[model samples]
Target: MKALLILAAIAIAIPSFSQTLESKQINYLVKFKSTRDLQTAMKKSVMSGTKANADQKVEVITEQMVLVSGKNAASAPLLKNQNIEYVQPDYELGLIETFKADGQDQKAQVMDYLMKNPQLMAKAKGDNPLIPQSPNSGAARDPLINKQWGMLDMGATQMWPVAKNNKTIVVAVIDSGVDYTHPDLVPNMWRNPGETGKDAQGRDKATNKIDDDGNGYVDDVVGYDFAGNDSLPYDKSVAAWQLLLGGGNPGHGTHCAGNIAARGNNGLGISGVAPNAQIMALRFISEKGTGVTSAAIKAIRYAVDNGAKVLNNSWGSMGEDASEPTENKALRDAIQYAESKGVLFIVAAGNGFQGKGYDNDTAARPAYPASYPYSNIISVAAIDTKNQLGKFSNYGVKTVHIGAPGVKIYSTVVGGKYSDQPIPFLAVWEGTSMAAPHVAGAAALYWAQYPDKTMAEVKAAILNSAAPISSLKGKVSSGGKLNLVNLMKY
Candidate 1:
């Protein structure tokens, strides 16, 4: 047993202290050189369809940019077309929706143990009525509350006194989509404050086919869908990923959102870490669990342009699948954009490079968005109930900032459309995906406590407030997992 433990310690090597096109889009992002009028040039030379088989429709993502479709070999001449600066294939990005936050069996056993021990359950609830009662209690109004072990692990119960009233603080859940209809989640979904009974001329801003907020989107009362190019960012239903009764639920965004801000004290489903914080649903990933970087970029812009001060990214690339991590310019630029706007991006460290774990501190091995060097970003790794690093979580002592409870986390699964039988509890879901929101929720609370601080200050406070753990000393930069109790006191 001693030898096995030694080998396991050796393998972890913690010292590292570390697409866009749209759904099924075969596209490339091209920028114009020194172009003043990008749209005019694109219309005249490319999208006009008058330029020898240029019938392809182009989506102008920004000022001088275009996510052009209808080409694989067709972009070669266009790159040389005097007006074009450069172009590259719109790479397809996938979500890390699966990982080893410990197996569901382990989680089940833990729950059984807790169930047998009422002492632990009572201790988990402590004195936070803002946090609902645990499951299995005749008195537990919300049966799913006890199932939410992740909240207890991160000290969310302790943070509630400071955050239960700040409904104006918004965190962008940039993934598939959130089930806004979920009773536990609806009250906390971010509503466009600009949405009123009527515009100056009496036209309904929520329904009028006009850009009421002048944010370039029409009738986007909740959030925008970059994947389908629609106004509603609600998680669209999928037969395979639905959270059917007695079925394995897979609504990625909804699950993440629930972890961040599902309403507490409602005696309904599980409680969220930041129940008072609002969620701005941004659907960039498709129902199929894949999407292009362009859509993600657009979603980031939308979130920042809106009132989302903290961005919770539960999905990322498989860095181990390639020779090294791929640096995406459009996506990097989007992160920079958010940083410039005082928006803090909380991202997951990643599941693995490609099923092969590695140290993130080494430049040769890294994760996108999370590993990207930025002050506004807070990279997160997954830890189990034991406070030990998860076997499947990627860590970098210098890169991955902190750790959080992720194994078999229970939260709100998609109810309407996204689910078949409406499983109120998304039990046993795992990954760094579940961990990022724990930090996001805390960040929202911290921002509320210090609404005057800049995004950088909030990021630093969260990182500096982590409770260092011996097991994770060399695994994560903070050498600790999230401790909301410490965060609030700090």
Candidate 2:
């Protein structure tokens, strides 16, 4: 009967979720009206006679959310604070890594190096020219590019020649920290014009003790790491192999960033979907692949305030499907704030095997934030090389917006830098997390070509251009998969 009710609510897209959800863990998101009100609220909110951590204090995470730690389910002290709007559990968000890293299989350092050089590549190929040699393998110059079927699936190469505008467009990879030093990724990172050299007060810009731009964070040159309350947002902590099934990876963010903007035509490594687009690394998740909901919200505001127009969120909360979609107001406020600021959010539809098996209609058993209603949000399902839905992907005819290639995708990892400073380590990854970025790259491509278009306009262009395939017919809202070639023609 409960299942029937949930399914019925999904069919109508009517939100029926009741109850303020929170984990048993000692953390919660408290929202106050203004920053000035935080001090008094903290005093009233801290529980007495508790064993919470002293380091856990009220950290003002965003304009609408605050991270309050050290409280048990025994008492809801945050709710007692004056001007406190709402407090919900700081839920755990998991990174969707469908496949573990197998490391790169290189052809040979000498041949690989020679093939990357346009001048040497022709001769290096000897008798064979560097063309789309065969359909079975898209191998061109970079050995791994051919293995990245997602690139070919979306027709990403067609825009490489003309999309110069992508460099100016910033797509924030809001997940684990990015490896800014990665060779294929280094050239394309977003430089902070506000925090580059010297502050208005004459402090050394890069290492100044002050918040150079008065943006709250001190010396956020690349991006801020809210999880650690620091500036470096590189993915650092990776759990072991058996732990991979649980969540967390050292190179997850780096992989996702590469999906959005790894360099193209460099003759090294795989090319990004929107190869020229700029990446703004926003690290809120930990090396352990877990983070509080408040941290994720802060990352979104940071991305929007820092001039990132498109945000790729390859993460989602761990929860089961209910009669109605779960709602997180504080998180929703942050997402809506970004959308209001003209940021397009490309989110991964949940992995089907999480707490809830959402392989069917995700709308009926919705995933938070993705299932959360917002026009600026583009919830993506995952598909394989054959254009079939991935076995692990979640879909919703009304909730998940579109499908994109997510299986066995080859992209950059942390162990290496660029070709010049090459300590290269690449891998073939999978997940709806991988799939969302493809749509993000597609959106970036469209946004780059028409820089002046509205987010709604860009969203429409992407959905309109999708190739309606039978495989995706009943599985997704679009009943089609993303078509970058068609998006470019639009």
Winning model by TM-score: 1
lDDT of 1 by residue, 344-395 (tens): 9999888774454456777454666678788898989988889878777888
Off by over 4 Å in 1: 1-26, 33-40, 43-55, 76-78, 81-85, 99-143, 162-164, 200-203, 240-249, 320-326, 353-356, 363-365, 416-427
Q: How close is candidate 1 to the true structure, as a TM-score?
A: 0.79
Model 2 over residues 82-135: C-alpha lDDT tens digits? 575655556556565532322343334434544464342221001111111111
lDDT score for residue 68 of model 1: 63
Off by over 4 Å in 2: 1-25, 33-56, 71-78, 98-143, 199-204, 239-247, 318-326, 354-364, 417-428
